[model samples]
Target: MSAERVHRTTHDVTVAAPAGVVYGLISDAVQWPLYFPPNVHVEQLEFDGERERLRMWATANGEVKSWTSRRVLDAVARRVEFRQELPARPVRSMGGTWIVEPLGADRCKLTLLHDFTVDGDDPGAVAWVERATDTNSTAELANIKALAERWANLDELVLTFEDSVRVNGPAELVYDFLHRVADWPELVPHVSRLDVVEEEPGVQVMSMDTLTADGSSHTTESVRVCFPDAGRIVYKQTATPLLMSAHTGEWTVEQDETGATVVSRHSVVLREENIERVLGEGATVAAARRYVREALGRNSTATMNLAKSHAENAVTVL
Candidate 1:
C-alpha cells in the first residue's frame, strides 16, 4: 500500500487475456464503463496527447454523484492512476491504481489499489463511501478480469488456410516484391489500408490498420525488410492497441534447387508487456513462447500461404 494516509483499499484479480490486450482495454478510459457496472460513466474534458482530465458519474442510493478526475498513465510500468478533483461531496479526495502481472503464458494477475480521504466536514459519510468503494472495487476487478479472459479465448476463433506455388523468377525478385510492403493492399483482400510512415536505410516502419475477418479494425505499427541472400523478408509489429511496448516476429525464405522458394514465417517473441498482462506470475520466457505458438500458429500458416501466392504470381508476371 502507498504510504499516503488517505482511505486505502486494494483488490486483485486474474484475467486470461494477453497483458497487452487487458492493458489496452483499461487504458482506454472512454471504454471503462463498457465492462464495469451500469452506474459508471467516463467523460473527457481535455486531453493533451498524454494525460486526460475527465469526469465520472455514478448513482449512489438513487442520488446522482459526480466527480472530476485526472487520469495519468505510466506506460513502462503498465499502471493507470486516477486522482479526484471536483464535485467534492463529503469525499474530499480520491485516487486508485491498476497493476498487471504475468501469471502464465495465457493468464495474468491484476491488482487495484484505491486510496481516498473523507472530507473533515463529513467523516461518517466518507466512511460509508469507503465501505461501498471497497465492495464495488472487488466486483469491478472481477468483472475486468472476466472481460480480458473472454478475449484471450479468441485463440480458438482463429482459422488458417495454407498453400504454396512455385515462382519461376529469382528468389531476389520474389523477395523484393515482398519487400515493397506498401503494395500489400493491392494484393491482400482484407487489407484495405497501408500507410508507410518511415523508410530508412535498412528498415521500414509503417502504420497498419487492418479489418479483421469479422469486419473489426485493429491498428498497429509494423516494420519489414528483405534479405535477398537468404531469400527471406520479415515483418514485425512494433506497437500495440494500448501499451507502448513492441511486439514482433520474422519470416524466412529458402529457395529449393528447382528454383521454387519455401517461405515460412517463424513466430518469434511475444511482447513482454503482453506476457505480463496475460500471465501475471509464474510465467517464463519458454512458457510464453509455447502459449504464443499454440494461440497464433494457425495464423502463421495462413500468412505464409498469402506470401506464397504473391511471390508465385509476381514471378510469373516477371
Candidate 2:
C-alpha cells in the first residue's frame, strides 16, 4: 500500500459564448482529440445518459499515458465530475470536475478542478503531477474558449464529417481490415506505400503515402488506437497538410442481425493563413471546408468500399 497525499489544482477562463456550447464540448469525450492537444484519443467503454466509463490516452510530461475514468454528467448544473478507475504509476488517485457558469446572454466561465494524490510521500512525484495538471488545465481552458467564441465569427476552425457504407460481412472482418493498416498499400489503390509499427499491443504508429486525384501523393503520420471488441479504430494525425492545423478520425464497424456497416469520421482544424495559399486566392473557411470534404472524404469513401469488398468477399471463407 502507498501513502496518500492529496494535491489540488484549478483553472478557469471566461469565454464570449454561452454556457451550453462550452458544456457540450466538455461533455463529448470522443471529440476531445479534435479539440484538446493533450488528449490523443478517447475510448467509450460504457455509457448511459448520465454515467460513462472511458479509457483515454493523452500526452503528459512529454510521454504518452493512459487511464480509465468514470464520469457523472450533471446536465442540470452544467457540471461534470470524473475519477480515474485505473490510475497510472506514481498516481494513487486522480479526479476532477468541470463547471460552466453563464455570465450573461453571451458570456460564460469554465472552471476545471483537478485533485490528485501520488503514491507514498514522494515529493518528486507530487511535483510532477502538479505540473502536468496545471499545464493540461490551462491548455484545455484556452482551447475551449477559442473554439466556442469562434462560431460567432463564422470562422469555425475545426470541421467534422461522417460517412458509412453497408458491408455484407462480419463486423470482426471489417474491424480487422482497418486494424491491419500496413496492408492498405496492397489493398487500397490510392495507397502507394504504407508502414505500421505496433510498439504496444492495440496501439500503432502508422505512416502512409496516398496518391491524389492529380497523380501526386501526400504522406501522413498518425497514432491509432484499436478496440477489437467494439470494432472501432481511432486515429489522430501527427503530420498533416499545410492547410490543416490538426486532423483526427475514426473507423467503426457496427453489427446487427442483418449485417454490418462500416462508418468513417473525419475531423479537421484548418489553418486560416494557408487557406488562400494552398486552396487558391480568396479562399475562406467555407472553401476550406469544402476542400476537406472532397479531398479527405474521397479517401475515406475509397477505404470504406475497399474494406467492404475484402471483408464481404472473404465472408464465405469464414
Candidate 3:
C-alpha cells in the first residue's frame, strides 16, 4: 500500500472550574498558550468592541503536522467556535465547545466537546479516525480536568478558609453581600488588610495581610477570587514558595423550604515541591488531610464570626 491517506482526531476534557470561568479563560485568546502549552500561538485580529476574532497556530506531536485556525466567540452562550484556515496532513475539519453548568450552590461541571472530520478516499484512514476519537477524547478530558483542577487547587498554599454559618437572612441577599472583599478588613479580625489587586467582571485577584499572635505579620499575594453571582464567592491562594499545601474553597448561601445555611467548603492539596520539606516522603496522606482540616477550622466560627456578621448585615442593608 502507498502512503496512507491522512485522518482526523478529536479530544475533549471536563474541568472543575465554573463554566463561565473556563469559557472566559479559553476565549481570552491571550491565555490560550498558557493552557495548551508552547505548541500553540494565539493572536487577536479584530474587535467589534464585544467579541474579537482570534488566529491560532497549533503544532501536532511531530513535524508531520501543523495548522492555523480562526476562532470566534459566542459571548452570550459562553462558547468558542473554530474553523481551520489551512489543513495540514490529516485534519479536514476541527472545532469544539467549552461548556459550564451549575451542579449546586458552590460547584459547577465543565465539559469540552470537540469534533473532527477525516478526508481522503481511503476507507481505513477514515475508520481509524472514527475509532480513535473515543479514546483520544477520554484522555483529553482527563488532562483538561487535571489542569483546571490543579490551577485552582494551587491557590491554597498560604490561606485556606471555609466554614458554615446560620444567618437569619435570605440566601440571595447573603450571597450578594459576601461578594465584596473590601469589607473583610473591617469585619474579620486577624484579617488586618484586604485589597483587590484587579477586577475583571466576575473574577478578581485579592491581596491579604494576616497578623500572628506574636505581633509578626505574614503577607500573601495573588489570590484567585471569583464572584459567581450574588450569593457565592470562591477563592484559592495563588502558588507561592512559602506554601506547602494549597486549598480552594467557596462561600455559598442556600435557602430551601426548611431553612438556609451559608456553606463554605474547600479542597486542599499538597504541592510536590514542598512534599519533602513539610511532610516527609513517608508521611501518610491522612496526616496532610488533618493539617488542612485544622487550618480550615482556624478560620471558622470564632475566627470568621465577623464575616458571618458582615454577610448578615449586608443582607439587612441591601
**Tens digits of lDDT, candidate 3, 135-203:** 544644554455556555534332334677776656665555566667767766777998874434655
lDDT of each: 0.60, 0.87, 0.54
Candidate 1 stretches with Cα past 4 Å from truth are 1-5, 121-123, 152-318
Task: Give Cα distance to truth, residue 203, candidate 1, Å.
Answer: 54
lDDT per residue (tens digit) for residues 80-183 in model 2: 99999998877889999999999998999999999988878599999888888888888889988978887565247778889999988888888888888888
Residues 1-318, model 1: lDDT tens digits: 333246778788878767777777678875454345422446688888668899765444323456798988776677888888884566767888888787777777788888777656356776677766866677678767766666744333222222244555456555665666688778655567788743234446678766654576778765554456776554445455432122334455557666665444332323344655665676654566555554345444555556666666665442
Candidates 2 and 3 compared: the better one by lDDT is 2
Pick the lDDT winner: 2
Backbone clash pairs for candidate 2 read none
lDDT of 3: 0.54
For residue 251, give model 1's deviation from the true position in Å. 48
